[model samples]
Target: MKRFVLLVVVAGLAGGGYYAYRNQRAGTQQAQASAVSGPRAVPVEVASVETMTVNEEVEALGTLAADESVIIASEIAGRVVALGFKEGERVKAGQDLVKLDTAILDAELKQALADLGLARDTNERLRALVQRGSGTQVALDESTARLASSEARVQLAKAKLAQSTIVAPFSGVVGLRSVGIGDYVSVGKPLIVLTSIDPIKVDFRVPEIYLSRVKVGQPVQVRVDAVPDRTFTGQIFAIDPVVDVNGRAIRLRANVPNGDLALKPGLFARLSITVDQRENAMVIPEMAVVPDGVGKMIYVAENGKARRVAVELGKRLPGKVEVVGGLKPGMQIITAGQMRLRDGSTISVKEKPVQTSQL
Candidate 1:
């Protein structure tokens, strides 16, 4: 009777365990089915497609330069006796900047003048004697030649005296002076640097494909790293007819007004040349563009789902990009949270679709 009771208890325990395990399995399957049938919507931020005029721009890097730059140098060797202007002072054209010692030059000029006077007196006296038949013709000719020679010497001396004074060639501000008073400087030695700052220049290059687009008088917008908060405007003043063999680009020059003298030479600058303009162009936020294989794409919210679209791109603005095809105005493009989405995925807008500005 004890063996019979033990066998019955073991069979009841096995049956109860199997029934509980089966119920748990069925519950798990039902939960999985529910999960598969209903999925959560992806939360995203969106922007509306816009229509506006867009400029086709060619971007390039260049350096700010002076409108006219020159290093003032000595034309003749001399000892600096006086500095007429202070360093970093604005000077007018032909303003005296430096004065060399003129003691020796003065003495030489005086001697030449005395010689010329004496030669003229002698020549006149000789001519009078020849008219009276007292002086030979050869004597008169020799005296006339001496007079000519003496006059030339006087003119030469005058030129040398003028060299003692060094003046500014143009209106500009003078840079640091390398030679001070009492310093001996040789010909061709640098004295100071003068640069015209009212109207500055910038030299840059662009690809040859834009040769037709870039022309004289085309407007340009320039920005420099040194002057981060400021933007300078200019226009194309010149262009090189020849293309660079190595870069396959054409060099260009633009003229920018700097009446305040804020812009400086040699500062690195970035510029955009407006080559073409499109009226009523379709544009979208640049952040909305997504890489789709070798092309580009964007996600648009439509009918409570995400619609993946491939786009043909055009000009790129500051914060926006031009859409050439595959998109239209009034579409809500997902600008944020697009990485977690797929085609036809359910989407819940995190906020109202924001309108983009013309950038």
Candidate 2:
């Protein structure tokens, strides 16, 4: 009986020892994981904040338009007898572009000239008789009035004759011809679309904060994707009086000389206006900026750790943002791996600094 009791006691003690050993192993594993993850050095990309000059530029999406864009239309009702020019032809002001049937107009003009001659002969004979006291003054005056009326009819006929031919009002490129030969057109009928592309107008908006920086007749720089290799120079042509309620932005227009005609109307353009350019401005890569709830925040490397701090941002350059406040020269900011960081996260920065290229 004693031997059996001793064996049972020994088995119970062995089981308890095994359970305690397993528990200690689990505790040690949890401690190792916690130590590795807690405030440990993490690999990250970083940038430095330095002082220099920055040009305050107002940026917005730009729309291309034409200063003189219109669709040419006919004023008088007539049949299209001829189309003088082909599509995409360069037309000059006063150049005839379309010709209508003028058979009826020519006949009317001839008749008007004959009526004027008959009235003038009658007026001359009456004036001579009145001077000789053979004709009454009233009759002479009535004849003179009749001749004047005939002269007006002749002028009206000439105007109608001019209307038979359609001419361009301004120099422009003619668009697709809406009318063809032998087509009957009514008054105000569209014949073709003409657009003056030279010195094209580029419309863009400026935020109200920089409204005072823009004005009429100011020079600006313009860039377009279609003409990637070229930078076009332009001048500000207009500024809106009212700010857009929703966006709080003011509309502006720039006149770009499209001498090569490389830039077409309706093509999108990215425009930059140099409002204020400083010779030396402090700037940092845009990626270093972390957005907080109210404004922007950034992580500065200090003693091999990331110290997040609030900053006041200013004008943004190619790939950098001008730090107006809360940072000084020679300060390092985490560029990459900023999202997985805290106020005092240990950072293992790469040996080589990141190179910031054109943005």
lDDT of 1 by residue, 119-173 (tens): 9999999999999999999999999999999999999889989998999999988
Error of 1 at 321 (Å): 4.2
Off by over 4 Å in 2: 1-53, 223-231, 282-359
lDDT of all the models against the reference? 0.92, 0.87
Per-residue lDDT of candidate 2, residues 1-359 (tens digit): 99999999999999999999999999999999998878568788877777886766665679889779788888777888988788997888988899889888889889999999999999999999988999999998898899999999999989878888989989988999878999999989988988899989999987888877777887778888988998888998789898999999898889999877888889999887877777657788998899999999999888988898999988876788888889878888889888989988888998775699997
TM-scores vs. true structure, each candidate = 0.70, 0.66
Model 1 regions more than 4 Å off: 1-51, 284-312, 317-359
